[model samples]
Target: MTKPIEVRNPRTGKFDYVIIPQSPKLLSQQCHRLRRGQIQWQELGIDGRIEALQQWKQALLSERDQLTEALINDTGRLSTSLLEIDSFFSTLDRWCHLAPQLLQDTAKNTSVPFIALQQTAVPYPLVGVISPWNFPLLLSTIDAIPALLAGCAVIVKPSELTPRFVAPLMTALNTIPHLREVLSFVEGAGQTGANLIECVDLICFTGSVETGRQVAVTAANNFIPAFLELGGKDPAIVLESADIDLATSAILWGSVVNTGQSCLSIERIYVAESIFADFYHQLVAKAHKLQLAYPALENGEIGPIISEKQAAIIRDHLQDAIAKGAVIHCGGKVEELSGGWWCRPTVITEVDHSMKVMTEETFGPIMPVMPFSTVEEAVDLANDSIYGLSAAVFAESAELALEVASQLDAGAISINDAGLTAIMHEGEKNAFKFSGLGGSRMGADGIKRFLRKKAYLIKTNASKDPWWFNEGESSKDI
Candidate 1:
C-alpha cells in the first residue's frame, strides 16, 4: 500500500494538497500500456510525432500562467519557479524543430569490399524517466521529449514531493489526438521508481548520487541500460585578473538560484589572494540584499527549502562550518517566515575543504568562499571534490581561462560564465566522476540514448564477394 504524499507550501508551511502514491502494480500496468502503444506510436512517423509535439507546445504555452502559479505555490520563489516553466516550453520548441533531422537514418561508408552500407537509429520501445523535484518539469519531460521524438513510448515517474505540476501537464498533453495512452505518468516514492526501472527498456534518472546508484543497480539486475544524471558540488574559480562585478553576479546567482537546490549549483568558490577581499565584500553585499519572502510574494528572490529535512541538512552544514573556524560573512540563520522552511542566504569566508559546507553538496542558499594564492592552486582546489558535474573559471584573459578550464576534471567547464551553461549545447554533457553516467539529454546525443544503432550492407551486383572465405578455413592473405 502507498501513502499520500503531502504537497507542502514551503512558503506558508501549509499542506496545500496530497497526491496518492501509485503502487508498484499500477506502475507496472502503466509500463505495459506504454509498451502496447509503441508500435502505433512509431507508425505516427517523424512528421506525425512533430505535429503532436506542436500541440503539446501550444498547450503548455496556453496554460503558462496557471502552470507558473502552481510551481510558485509548490516551491515558492515566483521568479525561480518560472525558470522551470520557461525551460520546459523552450526545450519543447527546440526538440520539435530538431527531432526530425536528429532522428533521421544516416548512410555509412563500407570497408568490406564494394558493398553499400547504412546505419539506422532504432529507438527502444519503452523508455523510463525518473525525474527529481528540484526542476520537476525540466528534468521530467526534457528527456522524455527526445525519447518520444525518437518514436519511443515514455513513462515518467515524477518525484513524490512535486507531483502536482506533472498531472496537469500530462492532462494538457493528452488533449492532443491519440496521445493519451502514448505518453504516461506515474507518481509515487522510490519503490514506484524501482518498478519503472525494471519494466522499461532504458532508464533515464535525474536525482542524487545515492538514489541514482540504486536505480543503476536495479537496471543492472534487469539487464537494461540506465542513464544516471546525479548530484554535483560544482565550484567557481576567480583569478586575480577576473572581472569582480561579473564574477560576483555569476557566483551569487549560480550559488543561490532555486535556493541552491540545483544540480549545477556552485557550492564552493576559490578566489585568488590578490582580489579576494574585493570579491568577498561584493558577494556579501549582494547576498545581504537578497529578499527571502513567502512564495505568495511575486518579487521574492529567496524562498524556503523543500522540506524540514532538507532545511535541517543545511543547518547542520552551516553549524559545522562555523564550528570549524569558518566565518559567516552574511546571513546564517533559519528564519520561520510565516512558519515556512526558510533559510537565510549565507556567505562564509576563511573556509577549507575540511568543513561540510566546503566538501559536501549543500543544496541550500550557502556559499563558501576560500582564497588561493595561485591559479594552479585554485584549479587544484576546484578539482579536489569527489563530484565533478560542472565547474567555472572567471578571468579577463580568455586564453588563460580556457587553459585552466581545460585542465579541470568536470563534464563541462565555463569561462567567465555560469557552470549551468553546459546544458545549453546539444552534445555530450557527461559527468566526470560520481556526478553522472552516459551522455547528456540534449542535442542528437540525447535522442541517441534511447536508440540502438544497426548497420546495413547491400550488394549492388550478383558477383561473389571478395572476402567470402569460410570461417573454418581462414585465408592468410587476400
Candidate 2:
C-alpha cells in the first residue's frame, strides 16, 4: 500500500498543499523481481515497448502543464523552460521508433585464435533509475523505457521536490498493466535513493556530482555496477568562423534553457577573439529579451530552483563568481514570486576555469562565458574541466569542427551548435566523462550498460582453456 506524505512546494512557498506517495519497500521488491529475471521484455518486443512509451509520452503531453508547474514549484524553473518537452518528445518518439532495432544483438563469428567460434553481446535485464527534478518527467521516463525494452525492469525515484508529479504518472501507467507492476516509483530523500541502490540489479542516476560520488561509492562498495549521468561544465567554443546566428542560438538555448538547470546546458561560453565583444553584446541582449518570472504551473518561460536550499547553493556560486571577478551580465539576485518558485535568468562573463561556477554544478539560471583566440586554445579551454559530459563548437568549417570534437575530452560534442543538447537525437543519449559513467546513444548504450557480459567457450578440439575444466573429458561431455 502507498501512504501519502505532505511535501512542500518550495516555489509557491506552500506546504502540505501537495501530497506524494511514498512506497519505498514495494518499489524495492519490484526491482528485486526484475533482478531475478522474472520479467520478460523479450515477449513485449520493440513494437510493444514502443507503444507503451508512446502512451506514456501522450500522457506526459496531456499533463505537460501540470508536470511543468510541479517542477517549477519544486525548482523555480520558468514556464517556457519545459520546452525541453520538445527534446523529450524527440527522444521518446525516437526511442519508440528505434530502440528495439538499435538494442538488438548482432551474431558474429568470434574468429578466436585457435578455433571456429561465435561472438555477440547479449542484452541484459533491469536498470534502476534515480532521477533529479530539473527536467523531471523526460529524464525519468526516457531513461526508464530503453531498459524495460531491453528486457529489463526499472525502479525509478524522482527527487523529492517534484514527487507530486507521480500521481499523473501512475494514471499513465494504467494502460501498461504489466509494466505498472515492474516499473515503480519511491519518493523520499537520499535514503530512499540509497536504498534503491541496494535493491536493483543495475542503476542509472542523473543528478549532482557530489551526490553522484556517494552513489558511486556505495555501488562500488557493493560491487554493484551502475551508470552515473552526474553533472556538467559543458562549454561552447565559437570560432570567428561561422554562422553568428547559429552560434548565438546554440549558446543561448544550450546554457539558459530551463534556466540553465540542464546538465549539458552551456555552462561556459568561449567566443573567438574577433567575435567575443559582438557575441557577448548579442548574448546579453538576448538574455534581456527572455521573460522571467515565477514559472506558471504550465507554460511559463522558466521556474524556481527546486528549493530554497538549491537556490541558496546557486546563489552561493553566483556570489563566489562575483568575488572572483566574473562579470554578472544580467539577472543576478533571487526573485520573490507569487505562488511559485523563481530565480532571475542570469548571465556571466569574465570567468575562467578555476572559478567555482566553472567547476561545480550550480544548476540554476546562470551562464558564464569566456573568450579564446585560436582553435588550439579553444580546445584546451573547453577540455580544461573535470567534466566531460558534453561540449559544442561553432565554426564555419565542418572539418575543423570535427577536428575540435575529436580533440575535446568530452563524450559528446555538437558542431555548429551551442548549448542545445542533442540528447533526444534519433539514436543517441546524453554523453559523458566526469558527467557520468558507461552510457551511449540510440538503443545500444543505456539498457546495454545495465547488462553484463559472460563469454561462453566450446572446445571442439578437446583443449581445455586451463581456467577450470579438463580439456578432453569435460569439454566433450558438455
Candidate 3:
C-alpha cells in the first residue's frame, strides 16, 4: 500500500488534506492512456489545439481569485503570488499567439539540385513536467500550454507542498472538453517523479541542482531529453558609476522578493570598491524598512521561508557566514512568527567567497555583499561558481552594462535592474553551466523543444539521381 501524501500549509503548519499516493502501476497505466489521447489530440491539428488552449486559459483566468488564495496559503508570499497570476496570464496569451506559427511545417531548400523538401515539426506524444513548489502554479501550467498548443499531451507532477493550488487549477482545466485527457496531474513525492520520468517521451524539471542531476541521468538512460532549470547562485554587480539608489533598491528586492526563494534571486552582491560603503548603507537601510506580515494583512513585502527544513538551511548558511567574519548589517534571525516558517530580511557585509552564503544558493531573506576593484574582477567573481543561471550588472549607461554583461557567464543578465524582468521576457529564460540543459521557457525555441523535426523529399520527375545509383556510377560528377 502506498503512503498518503499530506498537504500542509507552509504558513500555518497545519494539515489541509491527505492525498493517497498513486502507485507506480497506476501511474504507468495513466501514461498509456495519455499517450493514446495524444495521437487523436495531435490529429485535431493546430487550429483545434489553439482553440482548446485558449478556452483552458480562460477557465484559469476565471478562477484567478481562488487560485491566488490557495497559492498564498501554500507559499506564504502575498504580493508575489498575485504577480504570479498576472505572469501566468501573460505567458498563456503569448503561447496562444505564437505556438501555432512556431509548430507549423517549414519549406526547406535542397542544397545540391532540383529537389523539393519540407520540414515538419512533430511534437512528442507525451511530456512529463516535474514542477517545484516555488512558483508552482505558473511553472506547472505555463509549460503545458505550449506543449498542448503544439499538439502534445502533458502530465504534471507538482511538488507535494504545492498540491493545494495545483489541484484546483487542474479541476478548472478539466472543464475544457478538448483538454479532458490531454492534460493530467499526479501528486506525490520524489519516487513518483522518478516513475513519471521513465514513462514520458521528454521531461522538464525545475528544482535543486542535486535533484536535477538525477533527473538528467534517468532521462539519459531512457534516451529521452530533459530540460533542467536548476539552482542559481546569482550575483549582482553594482558599478561605480551606477545610480546608487536604483542599484540598492533593485538588489534588495531581487535578493529578498519571494522571501529570497527564487532561483534567480541575487545571492552574492559585488559593488565597485569606490561605491561599496554607500551602496551597502543604502541597501541595509531599505531592507530594514520592509514590512513583514501575513498575506491577510496585504501589507507585507517579506514573508516566511517555505518550510522548517528550508528555514534550517537558511539559518545554517547565515551562521556559517557570521562565523567566517561576515557582519550582519541588519536582520539575520529566524522570526518567531506564529504558525509560519519565518526568517528576517538580512543583509550582511564583509563577505568572501569562502563562505557558503556567498558561494552556494542561500534561498532565504539573506543578502551578502562584497567589493570589486574592476569590471574584470567583478566578472571573475560572478563567474566563480558551479552554477550560472542569471546575473545582474548595474551601470550608469546601458552600453557600459552591456559591455560587462557580454563577458558574464550567466545565461541571462539584467542591466540597471533586477533578474525578475529577465525571466518574464519572452526569449530570455535559460541556464548556463550546471544550472540547466537543453531548453528555454519562451520564444520559438520554447515550443520547438517539445517537437521533433522530420524532413520530406520529393522528386519532380521520373529521374534517378546519380547519388542514388550503384557504386559503379560514384566516379561520375553531377
TM-score top scorer: 3
Q: Write the per-residue lDDT of candidate 1 for residues 132-247, one digit (tens) a residue.
A: 87877788888998889898999888888777787568768778865666788887788878877878999999998999889888888898899988889999999889999999
User: Which one is best on lDDT?
Assistant: 3
Whole-model Cα lDDT per candidate?
0.83, 0.70, 0.85
Per-residue lDDT tens digits of candidate 2, residues 1-478?
5455556665557775444444666655666665554345556666766776677777767777776555545555544445555666676665566566665544444556445443444444556789987777777876777676666767788877667667667766765655665577777767778888877667778887889889898889877776778888888888888787777766877876666777778877788888888887787788787766433444446655566676777878888988989888888777667654466667788888778888777777777888888888988888788888888887889897887788988777788875534444434455556677766734456555645564545455665555666644644655
Tell me the TM-score of each prediction against the true structure.
Answer: 0.95, 0.83, 0.96
What is the Cα-based TM-score of model 2? 0.83
Stretch of 10 with least lDDT, candidate 3: 420-429
lDDT of 2 at 49: 65
In each prediction, how many residue pairs overlap at the backbone (N, C-alpha, C within less than 3 A)?
0, 31, 0
Extract clashing residue pairs from model 1: none
In candidate 1, stretches whose alpha carbon ends up further than 4 angstroms from where it belongs are 469-478
Residue-level lDDT for 42 in candidate 2: 52
Writing each residue's lDDT as its tens digit, candidate 3 over 244-342 gives 999999888888888888888999999999999999999988988987766454767887777667888888998898898999988887765666777
Candidate 2 lDDT: 0.70
How many pairs of residues in model 3 come into backbone collision? 0
